[model samples]
Target: MADLSSNAPPNQIWVAVKKQKVWIASGILLLLVAALSPDQARDSLGFVAQSLLTTAPYLLLSIGIAAWAVATGADNLIARAFTGSPVLMIFLAALAGGLSPFCSCGVIPLIAALLTMGVPLSAVMAFWLASPVMDPSMFLLTSGVLGFEFAIAKTLAAIGLGVAGGFIVMALAGSHILHDALRDGVGNGGCGAAKIRNPKTVVWRFWNHGDRVEKFGKEAFKTTLFLAQWLTLAFLLESLMLAYVPAETITSVLGGTGIGPIAIATVVGVPAYLNGYAALPLISGLMEQGMAQGAGLAFLVAGGVTSLPAAIAVWALVKPRVFTLYIAISLGGAFMIGLAYQGWTLI
Candidate 1:
């Protein structure tokens, strides 16, 4: 009775529009194509629709696993990665981080919890570095877009980068340079800390618990929306690029098998990278255009670890010097891995 509509948050329709902006943008692009070139528009629609259906299985599997981790409270089990010897901890942390399906935003609170609890920086570094690069979903999607061999290679790269970063921090532990790395005034992950500090028993039978079942539904919906929005935008862009961008241009700029293209790809990746899922189809397109295999791999690795959001998160938690070290390791490791992968391709 008190003009309740006036005080209500922006119209639900508008709120939804904002949330689904990427899809909207994609829709607009299709409309323009329909106006300018009706034939191509039909082909584009077919390509996008068919591509989505083809990848549907992979997306469903990834979403289920990710939601299961959340609903079962298995995400809180990251503490297990730190329980062994320093060297062993590094290995497990790296491997677990690579396999875990935690999103960038979700990983933040957990990392805060880990550092505040005095988890050794070496192992923490390992976990942090690897977590962004690969996860079960990423592996499946990459396999769908790229190939099994490349997906397998990227998984190894994630673990390898994590191990190298961890050991480097371990060696530097004596200097105490990175000691107490967190910036002042950061909350100890707030409510998120409790889950890590005292992990709850994971109920794999999440359907039995009303709360967990609800959580799974919400998480699955969220993940599905996230993947669909980004993938739709990606496939849209892919259609346009294939329609307009010349193979000669992509080939001349990014083609060839050598250190040069790989290095260039790594550098460009820092800026041009879309989110992990969105990047796959674009890289696949470039490869079809003669982009070097090593370059593609380097771009994926570099982008995964050094994207702006990832960098900002690391910078916020640690001192500038520690941030610098993270960047150095990420870039250097990406380059070296690219070279190694290039050599392997030749063999």
Candidate 2:
């Protein structure tokens, strides 16, 4: 007989012994126990509902914006426009990213496309940091959920950090590093190699290429599939955090004198993943339970900046050192902003 242990796919092997069914049964039993145990079930249910509420709007916005970018090829155009000065390019890229509706995951592919199209690394880095925080959808969500003041503060902070970080990276690393990092893939001979195709012709070809609705449907499906896997994992993690981690735990750990809250919040947030929309309810809960504003803001920024999917995408494109610098700049910038916001609030 074949070596069934080695040959069997994990899923198949698990199912062969009914382990999958057993696991599901055990999970249901535990859920039932949790439900019957105390008020924890009710709290967990409330948390889950709140989490969904906070996340849904941002999720919709991300999908819509991603679809729009793919359909119109606006992402490429913006990246192409930023090829002049690395510093200026970074600012423009960050600005564009801030305005666009792509989430951290969507931003990664878009930035990759931009870099592949010859956009500077500084610009790409700026976009990576800015897009999640500055996008219109996220801004609107923040305003609706967190109020106008916080929304404005978040937007300004995102833009400031993006610009400052980009400039710092450019200054420290120099333009040559960006050029060299991009040399192998983003050189002149790559995507930009095609002679300037006529704009009108391109438009006509796109319109004429297959059934427009069908083409759009296909693209949307592909994009959704790509996002669903990552987003689902993020959502699952969010649920786990809500279910198990008490608000008081976070407050107790992070809530303290002077920028300590900000530091703790930022640290907690670095590993967490959630759309700003999804995070609002959690933040509100934390705030209600004594989490400081600055700390909350820190969490928001950290989550936005250090998403797993975005980091993976960046790693694929740039050198490890460059990627590390991007993360460091983003985290430090977020920490400073969070601290400033908290300080201003106290003053």
Candidate 3:
């Protein structure tokens, strides 16, 4: 008998079983709801399914492009190019982060590596803060769902956040405040430096190396699965919200350009927001219901910066004071941007 255990990961098995359970539970819940209220169940389920279909292509393409970038050693090239003056490096790091297609979780290992490589904390912080806000894949999808102006504004906001965070950290450079920041000096190393064996033969040998090919395939597939699961869950939750939550209620609360509304949006966003990929449709729905553009943007920025996953990753790697500063910069920058946008629109 072939030993199948060596062929797949143990966690994968658990994940598969958990997914099966989710499907089973969802089916049973749907059946029960149908038994109780057939029309409501039908509408909600249909909306959920539609939402899944709508976002599938973007999610797939984003992960695929991101995976390819890693496999081709392009991300490494970008990471290694951040050596320069503080201002220049900070700007470049922010730009790279905006362009790189990575979530907060995905960027943690790179961050560790960069720090270990002696990259300035300022530049590392710049990239760390910027990368999760927007990427090529997210930009395309956001442009499609929202407007071009909104997408452009988001990209700028991400870079701006990175710049602000980087400069702030630079200012606190010699202070004892950030002296105890790094909790760990290394990461799991799974996402460590990408090594290109032969630059000239990379194209022809890309598909020839069995191990490399396997690695890329596994990564791409895993990414697809991870994103699809989140997207599906988010769509389902959105469907329920749309069905149960009154549109007028959301609008009345978040429709204003006042500091109060923007502040609420930012604070609420820290806990309420999900992954960037999952939050788009929900944000869109809220916008359609009359949410202010400034408030919506603030919510996205704050959540992207201090999201649970991202915050946890940072907390695990850094000390209390550094984490506090990270949160402060993110929150403060988000509010300023939102307020500025509101002012721009008024003028």
Q: After superposition, how far is residue 62 of candidate 3 from its true place, in Å?
A: 2.2
Query: Which residue pairs of candidate 2 clash?
Result: 54-277, 54-278, 55-278
The per-residue C-alpha lDDT of model 1 at residue 221 equals 95
* Residue-wise C-alpha lDDT for candidate 1, range 1-347, written one tens digit per residue: 12226555567657756777888888999999999999998888888888889899999998998889889988767667878799999999998889876656766777778788877889989987898789999999999999999999999999999999999999998675686688997679865577667877878898999999999999999999999989888887888899899999988888888678899999999998988999999999999998988889889999999987777778878888888889889989889889889889999
TM-score per candidate, chains pooled: 0.92, 0.69, 0.84
- Please list the residue runs of candidate 1 whose C-alpha ends up more than 4 Å from where it truly belongs after superposition: 1-17, 174-180
lDDT of each structure? Answer: 0.86, 0.64, 0.76
Q: For residues 1-347, could you state the per-residue lDDT of candidate 3 as single tens digits?
A: 22237566777766766766545555666677689888978887788888767766766777777666555545555654477898899999999888865534556666666666567889988887887788887886777667778889899999999998999999999899778567755553345533211222234245666776776787788777766666665666667677777889887899877898788888988988987877877788788777888988888889988987777767867788888888999999899988988777778
Worst 10 residues of 1 by lDDT: 1-10
Give the TM-score ranking, best first: 1, 3, 2
What are the clash counts of all predictions, listed in order?
0, 3, 0
For model 2, how does the per-residue alpha-carbon lDDT over 1-347 read when each residue is reduced to its tens digit? 22248878876776655623433543564487476755665555455456556656665665565555545544444444365677678877777767754434444445556666655566767777876666765676576556779888888888887888777866766554454564245333333233212111123234454564455566667555544443333334344555667878866876654677888788888776455555665575567566888888888888887767656766776776777787888789889999889888888
Alpha-carbon RMSD, candidate 3: 4.4
Q: What clash pairs does model 1 have?
A: none
**Global lDDT of model 3:** 0.76
The top-ranked prediction according to lDDT is 1
Best by TM-score: 1
